[model samples]
Target chain A: MPYVNIRITREGATAEQKATLIQGVTQLLADVLNKNPETTVVVIDEVDTDNWGIGGKSVTVRRKQGK
Target chain B: MPYVNIRITREGATAEQKATLIQGVTQLLADVLNKNPETTVVVIDEVDTDNWGIGGKSVTVRRKQGK
Candidate 1:
C-alpha cells in the first residue's frame, strides 16, 4: 500500500504521458520495494507556477526574471 | 527526501486540525527516523468522498448506504 504523489508544474503534459508516468512509477516501486501495484496508489498534481516557490521566490517570478 | 501526503475525506476539518496533523507527522518522522523536519515536505489533500473509494465503492455511496 505504497502511495505516491507526483507534483509537477502546470505545463502541458498529454494524458498519454501521464498514464505512462503512473505505470512507470508503479513499476519502479514494485521492482525496488516489492510493493503490490494493485494496492499502490499514485496521484499526480500539477501546480501553478505562482503557487510553487523556490528559494523564497515563486516559480512565476523566477521565470520572469530569467532565473 | 521524505515527502508525506495525508488524504482525508472532505468532511470539514478545521485549520487547527490541519496544523496539528502536519506537526504531528513531521515530529513522528523526526523522532523515529531522525529525519530533518525542515526538509520534509508535508502535503494534505482533502478529497471529496465522491472521488475516494473503499471496497470497490465510492465513499459517497458507502456513506449513503450507511456502510
Candidate 2:
C-alpha cells in the first residue's frame, strides 16, 4: 500500500522516461523498505509551470526572471 | 507543509472540477490538520487507465474483464 507521487514541470518528458521512473522508484522501495513492488503504486505528474510555485511565486514567473 | 495528491482515471474532468478539488483538499487539511493553506500543495493527477494497476492487472485490463 505504498503510494509515491512524483511531480515535475511539464517539459516534454517522454513516455519512456515516465516508465523508467516508475520502475526505478518501485525497485528503490523494494530494496530499502522491504516493500512489495506488486502493491506499490507510483504516479508521475507533469505540472504546468504556472501551477508550480516557489517562494510564493509561480515557476513561470520565476523562469521569466531567470531564477 | 502538507502535500496532498489526488488520483483519478483520466476521463474528461473539467477545469472547474479540478479547481474545486484543490480548494476542498486545501481546506480539509487546514481544518483537520491545522496546516497552513498557503503552505499546502495539492496536485491532482488524471492517470491513464493503462498506467494504473490493481490486483496485478492494469485498470484497462480490469475494465475489459469486467472485474
* TM-score leader: 2
lDDT of 1 by residue, B1-67 (tens): 4777677888887655665666677778888998876666556667899999999999999999998
For every candidate, the chain B TM-score is: 0.90, 0.81
Total clashes in model 1, counting residue pairs 3 or more apart in sequence or in different chains? 0
* Candidate 2 C-alpha lDDT tens digits along A1-67: 6887777898787666666677778778878998887788876667899999999999999999999
State the local distance difference test value for candidate 2: 0.79
Q: Candidate 2 versus the native: TM-score? A: 0.57
Give a tens-digit lDDT track for model 2, residues B25-61: 9998889989999999999878876556444445566
Query: Could you tell me how far off, in angstroms, the CA of residue B67 lies in candidate 2 after the best superposition?
Result: 12
Off by over 4 Å in 2: B1-6, B11-45, B49-67
Q: How does each model score on lDDT?
A: 0.76, 0.79
Q: Which 10 consecutive positions of candidate 1 chain A have the poorest summed lDDT? A: A50-59
Off-target runs (Cα >4 Å) in candidate 1 are: A1-67
Pull out the clashing pairs in model 1.
Answer: none
